[model samples]
Target: MKGFSAFLGKEVKEQLRNYKFLILGIVFAIVGLLSPLSSKFLPVLLESLVDDNITILLEDPTYIDSWIQFFSNTNQISIIVLLLLFSPILSKEYEKGSLVHMVTKGLSRQSIVLAKGTLLFFCWTVAYWMSGLITWGYTHYYFSDSTAEGLFLPLFSLYSFGLLLLAVLLLGAVLFNSAFVPLLTVGGFVIVSFLADIVPVIHEWNPLQLATRNTEILVLQEGDRLLAQAMGVSYFICIGLVILSIVIFRRKNIA
Candidate 1:
């Protein structure tokens, strides 16, 4: 924990100067706004595009529809951008030998790992909830019947899932010096998890459901135990990865 706070402050300031926060804020804000708006209007846009001779009947959009878009956009657009933006988090430091300089100047390896991990988690939490809250408010305004009684668990599951991804990302960044390799590491993780889900007994433990099954949970309110179990597993894995990264990083050669 030595110099953890100072390094975290440095990380925050660097992100600010680099416009990472601004870019993420804008991207998530747009993702938030688009959720409800697209749910409400995309049907009309599609219908209007059809020729007069074509008759298309689309179901009236609901708050559920809005959430569908929310999860979809967050998974497809927001998460992708977030990963790309931060994939080089540790790898770039490795490339520049900046961390070596800091290490030589009395910054502990533990502090660096903990500080960067904290930064990643903090950024993900803020941006993710910002998008969630925005969609929640707008969806309610547009559809008063949008009573998301079970929204919290689903949303929390998604948030927890992001933490899992970040943990993997941090480990990836530590193990690989190239930015793209970390991205591929995340991809490989998802692929393996996805494949593992094909086994019925393993599905309950799959963290991928946290990202993919939010809407189903919101609507039916089922799978509470499943999500809880998955969250527990994810937390355990996340902690392990961070620890592993710290160990690997401490022994890594930066010269």
Candidate 2:
């Protein structure tokens, strides 16, 4: 426990020194700010671009529109940024030959993987909630009459999906040496999951649905059971990946 805590502290400092926190903070904050602002002004912006002779009718943007922007931005750009930021996590340690010294100094390989995962998960949680809170606050202010329903389930599902992605990245890092390998692994998994979504038999239980269908879950009450199933599957997969990462890292030759 002490070793794990020490390594976790080191991971946190490394993230701060490397400006990971700064970059993620800025990106997610921008996403939060843009979601509500775009939803509120997009129609007006489009209307102004039209010639006086042309008439364009757009429905009044609502809180749902703000959430749509939120989900779209987080599901796409935010996840990409997260992947790029952390892709080199283990690879860089390998390249620098740092893990060898750390292990020799009495740190366990399991501790290293666990510490990295813990810190990354904490950072993601903070950034994700910051973005969501900003969106929530702005959405409420702009759409005062809007009432939020079924909010917690979708938010929880999205957060779980993010954790699952991080776990997969960790497993990829352990299984492959190159930084790009992990990125490709994670990307390929996502692509395959998306393609699998087209199959009716797998659609309801798909992990990708946790991310792609977040807005639907928030708005519709009918899909509650399916969303619960997806969330459960995602969390289970995340745990499995973390365990696999530990097992693979144990057998991996760092020297």
Mind giving the per-residue lDDT tens digits that candidate 2 earns over 1-255?
788999888888888899999999999999998999999999989988999999988888989889889989998888889989998889988988999999999999999999989877988899999999998889999987556677767777788899989988888888888989999999889999999989987898898888888788777834676777788888889999999899889889997
lDDT of 1 by residue, 1-255 (tens): 548999999999999999999999999999999999999999889988999899998889999999989989998998888998999898778878898899889999889988989998998999999999999999999986798787888888888888989999999988888978989999999999999999988998888889989889989966678888788898899999999999998898876
Per-residue lDDT value at 144 in model 1 = 69
What TM-score does candidate 1 reach? 0.96
Please, what is the whole-model Cα lDDT of each candidate in the order they appear? 0.90, 0.87
What residue runs in model 1 are displaced by over 4 Å at the alpha carbon?
Answer: none
Clashes of each: 0, 0
